[model samples]
Structure formats: C-alpha cells, structure tokens
Target: MRRIGLQLASVLVLLALWAFVAAMRWVDPLYLPGPGAVWDAFVRANSCYPITEGAARKICGESNYYLWEHLVVSLQRIGVGVGLGALAGVVVGYLMGSSRLLMLLVNPYLNFLRALPPLGYIGLLVVWVGIGESSKYWLLFLAAFPPVVIATIQGVASVREDQLLAASSLGAGLRERVMTVILPSSLPYVVQGIRLATGFAWTTVVAAELNNGIPGIGGLAFQSGVQLQTALTIACILVIGLVAVALDQVIVWIGRALVPWQGKEV
Candidate 1:
C-alpha cells in the first residue's frame, strides 16, 4: 500500500510539473503539448471514424485507422511473433541445454545475437524479405526468441546433480528424468523468459511496423511524428507504455499461477 501510494504521488507530481511547464509556455506546444491537449488528441484518435463518401480517411491519428484498430493490429502482430518465438526458443533451448555438442555448436551464435539489439537486424531482414509483413513478423520473432532460449538454458543448467542421480538410480531413462525432474525444475526460468520475451517483442513493434504498418499503434506514432502532431504522438506513446505494463503484469500473474514454487525462498 505504501509503495502504491508513493507511485501514485510520483505520477501526480509529474503531471503537475507537466501542467506547470505547459501553462508557463516553457516549451513549444508543437514539441511538448499540454496534458489536456494530449488527452484531447487521445480522445480524438479513439473516437475517430472514416466517412464512407470519397476517400474514406480517418479524422485523427493514422490516415486509415482509429486507435482501437491500431491497438488490435499491434496486439495481433506481437502475439503471433511472440508465440512462435517462445515455442521455437523452448525447443531449441532444451535440446541445446541437454546436449554438450549442440550447446557448443550454437552457443557462439547465441552469444553474438545476445550482444546485438533485436532491431539491429531489421535492415537485413527487410533487405532479404522485402518490406512486407513477413519481415515484421521475423523481426519481432527474433526480438522475442533469444531471451527465452537463454533462460531455458539457465534453468536446465541449474538442475541439481543429486536430482539427476536420484532419477538415474531409480532406473529412470533420459525422457522420464526430463519429464519428471528437469522440465519441472526449469519451468520457472522458462516462464521468466517468456515474460522477458514479451517485453522485447513489444518494444520492437515500432521498428517492425516502420514499413507499411498502417493498422498498428507504432505506425500511428510514426504517422503522427511525420505529420508534426506532437500531441497525438505523445498519446500513442502513452498508450504503448501503459499497454506494455499491463501485458507484463498479466505475464507475471500467469507465472505466479503456473509456477507456484517460483520465488518461494525455501
């Protein structure tokens, strides 16, 4: 409760400061619009609709979409990418973690990728795949892939020698040992990885949507920036930040439910 109170107080103080700056004209409205302006921009974007007469353009934000449309598309793109990435990461991570030869073969490349930002490879992906939806999906997939793999690897590695020995002494085969011991023991790490991957995929959405991304919030932000609609851009950014927090919280809650043993200091 105390922590929540502090957080709320901090947000209020920031808002007050922002209002003060806007009221005092400390910055140009074009650069830093007032909170009220930003709120109005958000409302316009959210309620915007296209007239079905001529060209059918939206009244605010993106030329083609209202805020909800942008949000839905963004969510879909992130969901597909993260889902594929998480699936592939778990499989590859488990295989590599279980085999010394495979780990040696792949660890160097994984290390290289870990050192690079997910967006850094977007240019190459675009160049190879062209500026299409595939490139965006691949970019976001790469963004979400590595963290989970590394986490799974760490989890597998953290398995105690005694657990393995006990399983072996009980005449358990490799498959049984993995299913009963390694997999369960490593679940917490895999969940953490998924959470981390979600964050990474979401952050990379703007970059992914940079090419032909009309129906996404990232694209909305880009369009607003291009049109010098600073208030709308700020509004889009706020939406992105809030949604990301909400997503992370969701994953955290799911992790708590799925891996109840996690974080218990026993």
Candidate 2:
C-alpha cells in the first residue's frame, strides 16, 4: 500500500509539473503540447461519434484505426516475433552452452547482432525482405533473439554440477536430467531474458513499421510526427509507454506463476 501510494503521488507530481510547464509556456505547444491537448488527441483516437441516428450508424475515429486496433496490430507482431525468437534463442543457447566449439562459432555473431541499432539494419531488411510484414517480423525477431540467447547461456552455465551428478547417479539419462532439472532451473533466467527481449522488441516497433504500418501504435506515432501533429504523436507515445509497462507486468506475473520456487530460501 505504501509503495502504491508513493508511486501514485510521484505520478501526480509529474503531471502537475507538466501542467504547470504547459500553462507557463515554458515550452512551445508546437513541440510539447499541453497534457489536455494530448489527452484530447488520445480520446479522439479511441472514440467515435455516431454519424447518423439510423440503425446503420457508422463509427469512425479521426484516424483510419481506433486505438485498440493499433495496439492489437503491434501486439500481434511482437507476440509472434518474441515467440519465434525465444524458441530459436533457447535452442542455440543450449547447444552453445553444452559445446565449446559451438560457443566459439556463434558468440561473435550474436554479439555483433546484439550491438546493432534497429535503424542500422532496417534498410538491409527492407532490401532483402521488402517493405512488408515479413520485414517487420524479421526485424522484431532479430531484436528479441540475442538477449534471450545470452540469458539462456548464463542460465545453463549456472546449473549446479552436483545436481547433474546426482541425477546421473540415479541412473537418469542425459535427456531426463536435462528435462527435469536443467530446464526448470534455467526457466527463471529465461523468463528474465524474455522480459528484456520484450522491451527490446517494443523499442524496435517504430523501426519495424517504418515502411508499411497502418494500424500500429508505433507507426501511428511516426506518421503523426511526420504530419506535425505533436499532440497525437505524444498521445501515441503515451499509449506505447502505458502498454509496455502493462505487458512487462504481465510477464512478471507469468514468471512468478511459472517459477514460484525462484528466489525462495531452499
């Protein structure tokens, strides 16, 4: 309760500061619109008034899509991208962790990929995969992959040798030992990686949707910025920030549910 109260108070303070800045003209509205304007922009994006009183009252927001549609499109892409990236990363990570030669072969490339900014490869992806959903998926996939790979590697390395030996002494085969012990022990670390990878994927969203994004939050932000609709852009950013925080919390909950044994004194 105290933590929640403190957090709410901090947000209120920030909002009050923002309102004061906007009121005092500390910054031009062109660059940093007032919170009210931004909120109105958000409401416009989310709401539609009835065009006709008849049965066929067509609903329409200011933009081509409502906020939910934009959110859904972006989330769908991230969902698929993260799922694929995590699967591949776990496999490659396991192989590399188990074999010195594989680690020597793959680590440099992984690091190189990890170090790159999304913009650096956006052009290459566009050329190779075209300006389509495939390109976006690939971009997001690349963004999600390396963090998870690194996490899994660390997790694998952290596995206790004694546990493995105990399982071995119990006549357990390598597969059984891995399935029962190693995977469980490493799961918490992998969840942490997924959390990290999710943040990366969210950050890459604007880049991924650069070429062809219609109903996507990041794309909306980019398009609105280009149009000089700063309020709408800021509204889109608020949506992104809020949704990212929510998604991160959801992942945290999932990790707790899946790995309840984690962090407990055993």
Q: What clash count goes with each model? A: 0, 0
Return the lDDT, model 2, position 39: 92
- C-alpha local distance difference test of each model: 0.90, 0.90
Question: Where does candidate 1 stray beyond 4 Å?
Answer: 49-61, 264-266
For candidate 1, the 10 contiguous residues with the lowest summed lDDT are: 53-62
Error of 1 at 155 (Å): 0.5
> TM per model?
0.93, 0.94
Provide the global lDDT of candidate 1 against the true structure: 0.90
Question: Which pairs of residues clash in candidate 2, taking residues 3 or more apart in a chain or in different chains?
Answer: none
Off by over 4 Å in 2: 49-59
